[model samples]
Target: MNVETETMKNEAAPEIRIGGGVPVLGPRDTPVAEVVHACHSASIDQGLAALAIPGLNRETLEPVLQYCAGLRCVADNVSCPGCKRRTEAQGIETLDQFILSKKEVIVGDGRVRLKGEGTETVTTPCLETLSKQWSGENYWFWARRVIRKLRHGLRRAHMRGEPVAGEGETPSIILMEPQLADNIGMVARACANFGLDDLRLVSPRDGWPNEKARIAASGANYIIDDARAYGTLEESIADLNWVGATTARQRDLRKPVLTPEQAIVEMRKRISRGERCGVLFGRERNGLETSEVAVADAFIMIPVNSRFASLNLAQAVLLTGYEWMRSDAGRSLGRVTTYEKPLTEGLYLGRDRPATKEELLGLFEHLERELETNGFFNPAHRRSTVSQNLRTLLTRLNATEQEVRTLRGIVATLSQGKGRARKREE
Candidate 1:
């Protein structure tokens, strides 16, 4: 009779706790099932090897590979020498072996084994459910997504693209209790300016998912659109093992609060070691509350004057982002040196011919009329002075043609007042 016992030791899964490497399955002769699980969960190289072979069903797949690594292999499809002749042979018939390449296969004959390399990779009909259909446009998109997923040894998405040294993985950012739309827009801009695209917002104040935020976001609309809104902070960061909070004031909890530099060091340490981490930025007015701070594994402080330590929500984001880039991680995450010259070859063909005299006069007339409407000209003040002041502000920015037009519209609206423009007496 086959040896059997209830509750056989399975040191394979994390469930088993044994000192000094004693096999969890008792004797070295423990069952194959327990042996397999132990080896698969151990590391990157071995786990994939197990997936490449057959025999263990998907259920037992993880466990058997976890333990059975470096164990003896079958010579033929049938029989192990340990199982003697004249006795029924227990062979693994479930091995649905596949070729790593078009040319080679790992095969075992009774008492003999051989290895051969495949010249070309075999095309097994795409087996996974989620694999996308191939298309020309997708070729580029998937390549970029794949690049985004890479963990190390490559130029990061934050930098200009490079030959694949490796891939960089973008981390997620979590915000708690946002009170203002401008702050949200600024945060969105910060995320886009850096490499972080995953934004999670919890319990927003006033109105969010509104037009005002979209307007403020400007070029960062995609980031704002992709942002995830949650009901609470804990739920927001639940998946992250390492959490950091930002604060400007003192609190009762003794949790370590680090300066932006120090926090980046700590967060960098964990990230390099493959820990999932998230940084929390609190509301605009009060910053993160004590309740929210309690759950954080660490705190990040922006060093500001004690008497005047307050910072706008977006300004804090800028500092944190700048620090994040200096972390050891920032180095490997694909930092590149921008050259003195532009990366592209040339500027637009018509970059600057300057508008004709007629165009310039027309622009000034439109602008003056717009300024006159928006209270840019006080009823009691010198109209020419007010108009000049308004002109100076726009001039300082060196407004582009398109931007000039948009500003004119806003001014025009102010001048015409909020009432609907009259429809032609229809």
Candidate 2:
């Protein structure tokens, strides 16, 4: 669930090449879509080169239409890499669909990524209420930035139900297909109160970047890391040795919907036996869908009025989590920090600058050749100050990883005898 932060990214256009090999366009002329399309094609180099040339207009892209008119045969053989093992059987028909959808196109290498048209908006009861609470729910819109941060944090590191250790118990909280951002945040708060750090949201309906969720989470934001969002109900409950389903209406499920007390007793028994198990909760409204109850090992229900039974999202999570805690499994398992890249030494005056070894050597070598070629360096008497000053100037700029690579190449070119001869000829 990576959120798209910036709108209208300016990408370099694609490059054109003949069918077999050969580049035809300069970098500026490369078509952006062609480069993106090549990501799906067979060969990257050839694909990139092909992208440089403009494809026929959408109306003119049909090979069959072109062939029928005796212009050119359209190639329908290319397949989409996203769904592999399946060739693009739709041909021109599929192309029309893509045009209609206006999918994102980025070309390079032999792989093309399609951030398909926006996700479908489900018209659930939750949507209407969520819209009222946190405004609209567009993942890419500028108004929804906090939501993007949450999405970024989740994607940068994989989240899981943290393992339990020591003689303490672990807390459990379930979020059934939370569709709105605010609901997820409120659920996080409920977990915080009952000492439940782990959360499971099944098949998130709204996707991610839910600002309402972050605003609602308040202080208990870290559980967002422990919150594991799944694609299906079974997947959400798979790891739990004991499962409890939250529902209001009576069902044919053999398992009973015990009050919070009865459910806690069973959960405690399971935990005492040193087993992993949890009590589940359904979405705020519409409760648990029929399919969700099918896989439950047991059922847990919150009794409400027969006519009006809607409860706040946080209230439900708290109810279930509070029940789980009663069984002696609702203690903090201690905080574990997951680090992304480890720390490293930077370029220093005494220890030497970053890329302290090879990059420095390359930089010096490059500088000497450039000076010599431009007649800037007096060969008869080399002045150390000149070279040192040059280094100081470049180091201050803090050249980027790519800039350094390019500079090194320039130096290597100027240092070669053939290069010098060619320079003289030019």
Candidate 3:
């Protein structure tokens, strides 16, 4: 069988042949969802050119490109087969060869036009429809991320272990009906930030194990990898003995309302007695319904300006995690590594002690002597008062031993003028 016949036999749907025998995944009228799936499953070597559905130009390609693992010409620079062969013949294996040899395609104002080649132009769908379909989703930026991952591998691929919070140490963070995958990724990062280990999701709108969430997670792969998604809120919190729902709006429920600090404290107390505790966060658009809030043992209300009480999904989780870690006995002020020690609340004096009384007195005398030589006291009657004022000023510095020595050196240098003054005296 020929390549076309073999290709058609293998494909689930009829292939639309383009660019002289290159197999397009579907017909010209293929839906956006199928196009996206085809692009994701397409081999990196074949690229977007092979999956040429109608209206699959740069403007409409972002949503498809983000899901793709490897598409060699996903950038503004479009690579042709001839250029690839030429570069390969010259033994150029780097990405620069492909980038340098490709033609530039300009995408803007609902049009995709090739600049360097024959100037092929394709008009895209209306902006309003695009916006409604993918609100706040930047597919082009996401495409770059996909290209980056294809080149460098997944972010923090080597990091894998138990959660930052040890077994049963921190409370499980539960997100209810999170709409955006990016928000979920950010929540994972926040969980990693303050040692909150477990992350549970109930009916995420974008579905679980999404690449967008993984990309947004930034480097909290461990949290994203282990995050559990349940069908319902009840199933998510089924394992926990006590759960607290976070809300900014006032609810008429009789459940006790506590601040983040108080909730963390209460959870800690319950966990000490071997109870599994969790914190429930609401959806991004609208918070938990009264019934959902009612299911929780207590409702947590973070202190905020009454006018603007709503917080971002990740922000709520971050605040709760911060409170959980704030009172930890082993917690450091910041990151403590091998060469950097844990800091406390005080003045940091490294390798130097406070100035001794003798050192301080010597500084005072030296300063006073210099002032006397310079006639800074003005009247002789005011000499005692001026000297007393100068002593007080110097004493208030609370200088270290090294600081005292440096001040004395500065005074000597100013008063005597070093080598020149000695030569003039001689």
C-alpha local distance difference test of each model: 0.53, 0.53, 0.71
Candidate 1, which segments miss by more than 4 Å at Cα?
1-171, 328-426
- The lowest-lDDT stretch of 10 consecutive residues in candidate 3 is 76-85
Number of the top-ranking candidate, with lDDT as the measure: 3
Each prediction's TM-score versus the true structure: 0.39, 0.40, 0.68
Among the numbered candidates, top TM-score falls to: 3
Task: List, residue by residue over 1-426, the lDDT tens digit for candidate 1.
Answer: 333222222223332223232233333334333333223222223432444332222333334333223222222122111122101222222222222212533222223222334453222233331022111021222223222222231222233322121122345678788977667878877766665666788988745564345545556776777777889887888778788888887888888878878877776677678777778988876788889888998878887889998888878877777677554232433333563322323333234443344544456678776555555566746887766766566556544555555654564555554453222111
For candidate 3, give the lDDT of residue 248: 88
**Model 2 off-target regions past 4 Å?**
1-168, 208-212, 326-426
Better of 2 and 3 by TM-score: 3
- Model 1 RMSD to the real structure? 23.5
lDDT of 1: 0.53
lDDT of 3 at 331: 79
Ranking by TM-score: 3, 2, 1
**What would the per-residue lDDT of candidate 3 be over residues 1-426, giving only the tens digit for each residue?**
898645544544333233332223345534223344433333222334666443444344554454322333333223223223234444556533323333543335636533433223323244333224322233234346545555566677666645755677789999999988889989998998898879999999878877667767888888888899999998998889999999988888889989999999999999999999999999998989989998999999999999999999999999999998897878777777899999876778877899999999999988888888999888989999988888898889889999998998777778888775456435
Give the per-residue lDDT digits (tens) of candidate 2, residues 48-133. 34543333222222221222123111242222122211213333234324323434433243254334463322222332342342
